[model samples]
Target: MRKKLKEKISEALSSVLPITVIVLLLSFTLAPMPIGTLLLFLLGAAMLIVGMGFFSLGADMAMMPIGEQMGRKLGGRWKLIAVAVICFLIGAMVTIAEPDLQVLARQVPAVPDAVIILAVAAGVGVFLVVSMLRTRFNLPLGPTLIALYTGVFLLSIFVPNAFLAVAFDSGGVTTGPITVPFLMALGTGMASIKGRDEDNFGMVALCSVGPILAVMLLGLCYQSTEVSYTPFAIPSVFDSQDVGAQFLQGLPDYMKEVALGLLPIILFFAVFQLASIRLKRRAVIKIIVGIGYTYVGLVLFLTGANIGFMPAGYYLGTTLAALPQYWMLVPIGMVVGYFIVAAEPAVHVLNRQVEDVTSGAIPQKAIGLALSIGVAVSIGLAMLRVCLGIPIYYLLVPGYAVALLLTRCVPRIFTAIAFDSGGVASGPMTATFLLPLTMGACEALGRDILTDAFGVVAMVAMTPLITIQLLGLIYQRKIRRTRDVTQAEEREIEFVDEIIDYNEEVEL
Candidate 1:
């Protein structure tokens, strides 16, 4: 347990530290924020990172195994009821736990957080059950997604303009680190009963569609006020003492905040531990220790991000855009997107699970490459959106069209992983680091952050759906070619044997 906890803390620090250094350099060199503000940002970043680490630990030690076991054990007699209940509970738990949802809720003036959270959670639960049914009966994921998303778009037309972006964002944000691993595991376990890889892997994609429709429907149901955001103001950092004091002062606040966020997830895990997993007392104790490490790691990460990294990111974007070499923004943005996705803790679990389910046929390297390309394109497009002040709808419409079309062509398993990939790829780092960086750049460029910066997460979530499905198509074609060659070889061997037998008989 101690070792596991240490590892989580180590991972959190290592992943977060590079961004912190980058932020510090940018803070001092570019925006030169006040020392107080710089420290606050650093503190927040640490807490965010540490919180993620602990949350991930809890998910693994408790949530994931429990979900998988539940899926595996549920009998045919109760499959429907078991699936519906689990999906609804997991979806609701995840939606409620999502920090991003909370952020979006605050942005919407008319819809209360409780209302939006419950509504979105309900949407996820319903869709999740639908997904489970699709896998159970061998339903095609592509057509189902197309039909569902069509409804989402139609409803989007009626939703208040103010709620459009936030609504879209809600879809992406609901599939965060804690929610993703457990949900994917649950889907895989459910799919495994059928012993079909395609069925197992595609559940994430189907589940992802549910939130988009849910949030869009929400937009129509709630008439939100026009959205607005204040850019992060540069802080003055004159000396080391100022940075130290700022971090010191903000530490307790973040500690409390992260603890609050982690409690529910932990409690959920505990309930599962007592009721489901039934690990020995010693094993449970070890898991408890792992949870503690996770907590420490999260605190460190969040504090670092909010205090040191975020301000620096904002300043860097502001300064870079201020440069005569504006094109520099694209390359830098792409690079950050590429690395940031790798650092999203949930991504590790996703990649590993993909590899395991595919028997190493779908290498983690492939998923990484696909995710990188998707993120790069998303960021590049986001920068363009910021520069042009283009409506997000222009890009999203084409993007979803391409994604949905690919869903039909790709193998079913790929579709599931791909859709889930979109959500996993856009996890916490994108929110804390990439969003702020883009927002700062947009601010410096005099662009509307709401129209531009706000949509990066949605874009990040969309592109993976297309890219991974493309990979799936390639895999499908390869399988066909291999099968054809094998058949031809067998025929040739049979023909040769007949000729040899006839020739030997004539000689005799």
Candidate 2:
């Protein structure tokens, strides 16, 4: 257990440190923020690292094992019903806990935070069950995604434009740090029971569709009012002490928010431990400790992104964007996007899970490369939208269409991980930094901010679908060629065996 803790802590730090370096460089070179703000940002980054370390450790200790164990035990009388109920609850709990969603929920006008959280949670629940069902009966991943997305597109025709981007953003945001690790492990663990490799891969893919439909339906329900929210600018104060104090005061609110978010998952796990599976007491205790880490990490993560990082990002973009050379938006935004995706707490968990799920055949580095490219493209496209004042649908519709089409060509598991990547990639950093930066750029360029600036998150969410699926297609083709070579070898061996047998018979 001690070794496990050390390893987890080391991994989290390693993951976050690179991003912190980039942030520091950005602060000094690009933003050149005040000393007070820089100090606050560094403090926030430290908290984020510590929080993430504890959180990932806790998740390893509790969430992944518990999910796998429960999934493995889900057999016998009323198992189907039982699995469905558990899936729904897990989906709801994790989605509610998503930090990115909480960020977006706060920004959304005329909607209670709870309302948006619940709506997104419910969406995740419904889709998770569908994912489980796909596992139970070998449903082809491509057709299912195509059908579901086709339905979503048809619905998009009448949905309010204001809600469209927000709705899609909800889909991506709901699958955050706590949710991604747990869901991927749960799906893989559940697949283990069937003893089928193909069954394991598509759970992430299938579950992604749930939020899209849910949010689109949500768009239909909430009459689209034009988004009127303008982000609050971070005031540049000379006093470092005051900046520290303001951050500390704001920290507790996020602590409370994350505490509430984690409660449902903990309670559900507890109930599962006692009533149904009856695991040993020691294991349960370990999981409980893990839950503590997850909660602490989540609280700190939110505080850093919102209080420290967000304002810095907004101010930086506003400053750089105001320059006469509007093209500065493209390169700076792209560089930031490249490093920023690595900072997202969920991306670490996602990459690790993908490697584990594929047994190193799909390397974490590969996943990172794919993500970097996708994010780069998304950032570029987002800047274009901001510059041209283009409607998000024009980009989103085509991107998703290509992504969904690729799902058919790629392997089943890749499809799941790819879709899941979409959600994982568009996490807190995207919201706090990328969104604000794009917004600032748009405001500077004199473009329509709502229609243009608002959909960067959506774009961030969409591009991964294409890149990961492209990865999947490449993997599938490789797998096929390998199989062909193996088959040829087997045939040659069989021919040799037959010749030997004939000679022995003739000699006899």
Candidate 3:
């Protein structure tokens, strides 16, 4: 156990260290902040690394197993309606558990946070029902996604522009750290009963769609107004002691937040254990310990992200935009984006599951690289929008169109994984750091934060659909070529053997 925990922390160090280095470089060269702020940022990075490490381990221990067990129960001979209702409840409850959703909920100005969160949860529940039914009935994911997203765009017409961006961004944030492992594992459990690779992958994809549709509908009901965003306040600290005090002050709030976020899941699992799925006592204890790890990890991670990273991202963005060479935002953002996706806790969950689901036919490394490139492009585009004020629809409409188009072009399993990657790529890290960065830049440039800076997560979500599918195309072509070569060699060997056999017969 100690070895495994050490390994998890080590993996997190590698994942987080590059982004930290980049931020340090930026601080020293292009976007210097006060030494106190930099020190806070460094402390936050350290906490982030440790928190993610423990969180990843906890997910493996608790969330994945719970999801798999629940999925097994779901695979029973329940009526379709029963399954749908259960799935809806699970989907809604699990979404509310996501810390990333809370982060996003705070940013949108006019809507009550509870209203937005509940609406998004309802959307997830409904779509998760669809996902389960589709799996049970053997439906094609591509057509279903196309139909739903088509409706999404149609609904976007009625939504206020500010709300539209938030609506789309909500899709990305919904499938965050707490939700990803469970959803992915649920898909795996379903597949274990009676499913293919595609079945093991598309739950997250389907669930991601629910929030966008729900939020857009909510926007239609609500009145539009000029939304105001208060940018991050740079910290003022005299000494290192004050910085420690700041983190200590923030820790209790996050502990309570994490506790509340986890309570539903723990209670639900308890009920589930007593009612439907009983496990060994030892297993239950392990899960309990894992939950403890998750709580501790999340509290640390949130405290760091909210207190340390937010201000740094804000200052960096504002300082860079204030420069004469503001075009540097695009290139700098691209670099940051490339490395940042690796640091996302949900991303590692997806990558691990993808590799495990495919039995390493698709590697973790390949998924990581594809996701990095996709996020890099997305962030660059997002920064460009901040500088030039491009409406998000201009990019999202065509981007999703192409993504939906590729659903038909690539292998179906890859399509599932690709869409799932879109959601995974835009987890807590994107919401916490990248969104703040864009918001800061928008504030500095006097752009509308709602319309201009809000949809960066959506952009982060969209590009992976295309890039991973493109990777799939490459994978398919390679397989075809290898098959052709093997067939050719087999034919040649058969001809040569026939020749030898004929000669031996003649000699006999």
Candidate 4:
């Protein structure tokens, strides 16, 4: 356990250190921030490192097992209606508790936070049922995604344009840190019983869809024209004591929030364990420890992110965008996007799972690089849109069209991984940091926040669908080449044997 904790901390540091360095460099060179803000950012980075370490370990120890056990048991004996209800409850519970969803809910001005949260949660519940049914019936994922997304776009036309980006962003943030590990494990457990390799993935991808559709419908109903944008206030701290006080002040609220977020999951596990799971006492004890770790980690993580990184992101975006050379936003955003995705804890979880599931054929290093490149391109495009005031649909429609087109060209497993990667890439960092950065830039540019600044997550989510599928295309080609080479070698060996036999017959 100590070794695992140490390893997770090391991974967290490596993941976070790059982004921290980048932010510091920007503060010093390009967008100089106050000393207090810088200190707060550094302190936040420390908490993030520690928090991610504990959180990753907790998810592996507790959430994954619970999800897997439930999936295996449910897949075997539960009636369809029962399965649907349980899945809905699980989806709604986890989503409501998702930190990313809460962050987004706070950002949107038109609807009450509870309304957005509930709407998004209910959406996830419905789609989770759809995803489970798809896995059980062995339905084609590509056609289903195409049809669903087609419906989403069609619905978007009637919904307020301002809400379109928010609707899509909902999908990306729904499959965040808390949701991904459990849902992915659940899919794996369910797929194991279904006797299909590809079914283990695409559950996150499908579940992500529910929020977009639900939010779009909600947008139509709410029909609010004005969105209020409130920027994070940069902290004023003159000393180390002040930084300590700031973090300490904010810590308890997040602690309570995280605890409330975790309670439902713990209770659900307990009820299910008593009713059907009946896990061993030793296992239950381990999970209890894990839940404790998860609680502490999330509190620290959210506190650090909200207090430290949020202001830095907003300040940096505003300062950079306000520069005479405002065009620098594109490249700078691209660079930040490249590294920030690596910092997202959920991205680490998804990459590790993908590597494990593919038995290292799809290497973690490869997935990381592909995701970075995809996110970089997406951020560049997002900054461009923010700068130029382009409609998001202009990029999204073509992007999804190409992603769906590639579905026919790659293996189904890769398709599933690609789509799931899209959701994973746009986790907490995008919601807490990138979204604020975009909003800041839009505010500086005097553009409509609702339309211009709202879709960074959607863009982050969209590009991975194409890039990973492109990686899949490459994988398929390599597989075909290897097969051809092996066949050629076999034929050559047969031809050599035939010559040897002919020579022997001639001698006879």
Candidate 5:
């Protein structure tokens, strides 16, 4: 246990340090922030590192096992209806508990929080069913995605323009820290039952689609023109004590929210344990401990992010945009985006999973680099949109269309990884930090928040589809080159052997 804790802490520090350095550099340079804000951000960074360490450890200990066992047991059941219903319920329940989704829900003003939350949850539920069916029936994922996204775009056409970015952002946020570990493990568990390699992936990818469709449909039903965004309020702190007080004040509220979010999952697991799992007493005790760790870690993480980092991001964006060379926002955002993705806890989970599933064929380093580049480009583009006032659809339509087209050229596993990476890349940090940053910049540039600032998550989600698949194309090329060399070597050896045999015959 001590070893695992140490390892997680080390990983968390490494993951978080790059972004911390980047933010500090910005604060000291082009985007000079208030000293109080800087202090708060530094404190928040500490909490984030520790929180991520505990959360990752707890997820390994508890969330993965719970999800895998549930999926395995449920997948084996003969009753399709029962399996579908249970999967749907689990999907909806976990999504409702997602911290990232909650953050996004609070930001969008046109729809009530509950209405958007329920709608997004329902989307997850329905799509989870579709994912299960796809796995069971061996449906082609590429085509299904094409069809689903086609429908998404079709629906977008009818929905209010303001809701377009929000709808897509809903999809990205739903598959966050809490949702990824469980859902990925569940997919793995179900795939194990099927004994197919490809089945394990694309669960998160499919599940992501649910919220987009659901939120878009909701937009059509409840169109509101009064879309407004509340900017992040910079906390005033005169001294260290005030800074401490700020975090302390926010801590309890987040603790309560995290507890409420986790309660449903714990209760569901308990019922599952009683009904089906019957895990050993020792195992159950371990999971309970893990749950406690997860709860504490999440509270700290959310408190630090919302109370500390968010305001810093907002302030930074506004400060940078107000500069004479406001175009610097693009390169500055790109650099931040590159490093910021490393701060996403769920991203680490997804990278580890991809590595394990591929037996290290796809290294975690490669995944990390690919995602970082993708997010960098996404954020750069997002800033460009905010600076120049470009419609999101102008970017999104071509982006998705290109992503769908690439599905034909790349290996299936890359497609799954790419799409899944999209969801994983846009975790809590994106919602809490980048979205606020974009909103601040948008406000500074005198652009509409709903139309301009709303799509950062979606942009984060979209670019990985192209980048990872591009990685896939490169990977495929390497494989082919290796194969060709091996084949040529074999042919040369055969030729040599034939010549030797003829000489032997002549000598004889």
Candidate 6:
């Protein structure tokens, strides 16, 4: 256990260190920030590394096991209605507790936070059930995504133009850290039924869709009021004590939120344990310890991200954006975007699972690179939207059109992983940092904040669908060229070789 934690932390440090360096370089060169802000960011970066380490270990120990066990139990003898109800409850519960969703909710003014939360939660709940049912019935994922996404686009027509970005972003943030491991495990467990585990990759993708549809419908109903934005305050620190105090003051709020965020899943696991799938005592204790690690890690992570990185991202966006060469935001943002995806907690979870599911056929580094390229392109495009007022639909309609079209072209697993990657990639990092970064630039440029600033997460989510599918296309062609011969083919070739050998020997 200690060795694994060390490895996890080391991996996290390497992943996080680059972004820290990038932020520092920008601060010193292009976007000088206040001393206090830099100090806070440094502190946040440190905490994020430690927190990611703990959280990764904890997820392996706790969340993954609980989800798998629950899934296995559900795969047996449960009625379809019962399964649906359970899925809905779990989906809504985890989503309501997602800190990323809460952060996103606090930023939007189109609806009350409670309304947005409930609406998005309900959306996730319904789609989670759909995901499981599809797995149970052995349905093809491609056409389903095409049909659902088509419906989502049709619903967008009814949504007001100004509020469209928020609707799409809801889909991205719904599968944040708290939701990813569990929902993914649940999907794996569902797919494990009868050993038909080939199609376990699309639960997060389907769940991601629910929130967009839900939020779009909400946008139409709530369009009567103009959307509003409240600027997040930058901290003031004059001394070391003030830096310590800032962290001290911020700790309790995140502690409460993280605690609340984890409670539902923990409690559900407890109930499920008491009722069914009761494991050995040692296993339960290990899970409890993992849960502890998860809680502490999350609290620290949220504090660092919101208190530290948030201000830095906002400051950079505002400062650099005011320059005459504001379009430079594209390259700088792309550079930042490359490493930022590595820092996303849920993204780590997704990459690790993909490697495990594919049995090392798809290495972590490959998926990481594909995701990095996708996010880099996304950041560049998002900056373009910020620099010039591009409509969200201009990018989204064609992006989804291409993504859905690629589903027919790639292997089913790649399509699943690609769609799921879109959601996982737009996690806390995108919500807390990139969203603020783009919005800050948009605000500085005097563009409409709602239209320009709001769609960065949607952009972040969209590109991976294409990039990963492209990777799959490459993998498919490579395999076709170098496929392993079947036993019959090998035997026939050997027989021909033996016949040649016999003729040669007899002639000699």
RMSD of each: 3.6, 3.2, 1.6, 1.5, 1.4, 2.2
Candidate 4, residues 171-190, lDDT tens digits: the string is 89778777788898899889
Taking all chains together, the TM-score of candidate 5 against the true structure is 0.97
Off by over 4 Å in 3: 103-111, 505-508
Selected candidate, larger TM-score, 1 vs 3: 3
TM-score of model 1 relative to the true fold? 0.86
Which scores higher on lDDT, 1 or 3? Answer: 3
lDDT of 3 at 430: 86
lDDT tens digits by residue: candidate 6, 123-213: 9999999998888888989999999999999988878776678778888877888888888888888888856545668999999998898
Off by over 4 Å in 5: 106-112
What shift in Å separates residue 396 of candidate 6 from its native position after superposition? 0.6
Scanning candidate 2 in windows of ten residues, the lowest lDDT window is 70-79
Model 3, 1-508: lDDT tens per residue? 8898899899999999999999999998999888888888899999999999899899999989988888877876877788888898989987887776776677665778898889889999998888888888889999998998998898888778878787898898888777788888887777777858778889999999998987777767767553545556777876899899999998998888778778767887898899988899999999999998888887888888778788788889999999999989999999999999998888888888888888899999999999999999999999999999999999999999999999988999889999999889988788778988998899889998888999999999999999999999999999999999999999999999999999999999
Please provide TM-scores, in order, for all candidate models, with all chains considered together. 0.86, 0.89, 0.96, 0.97, 0.97, 0.95
Model 5 Cα lDDT, one tens digit per residue, 176-208? 777887888888888888887667788999999
Score each candidate by Cα lDDT. 0.73, 0.75, 0.87, 0.87, 0.87, 0.88
Candidate 2 per-residue C-alpha lDDT over 391-478 given as tens digits, one digit per residue, 9 for 90 to 100: 8999988998999878767777777777778878887778777887787787778776767887788789889889988888888888
Model 5: lowest-lDDT 10 consecutive positions: 223-232
Better of 2 and 5 by lDDT: 5
When summed lDDT is taken over every stretch of 10 residues in candidate 1, the lowest stretch is 70-79
Better of 1 and 6 by TM-score: 6
Model 1 residue 59 distance off true place after TM-score fit, in angstroms: 4.8
Question: Which residue pairs does candidate 2 place in steric collision?
Answer: 58-290, 201-413, 205-416
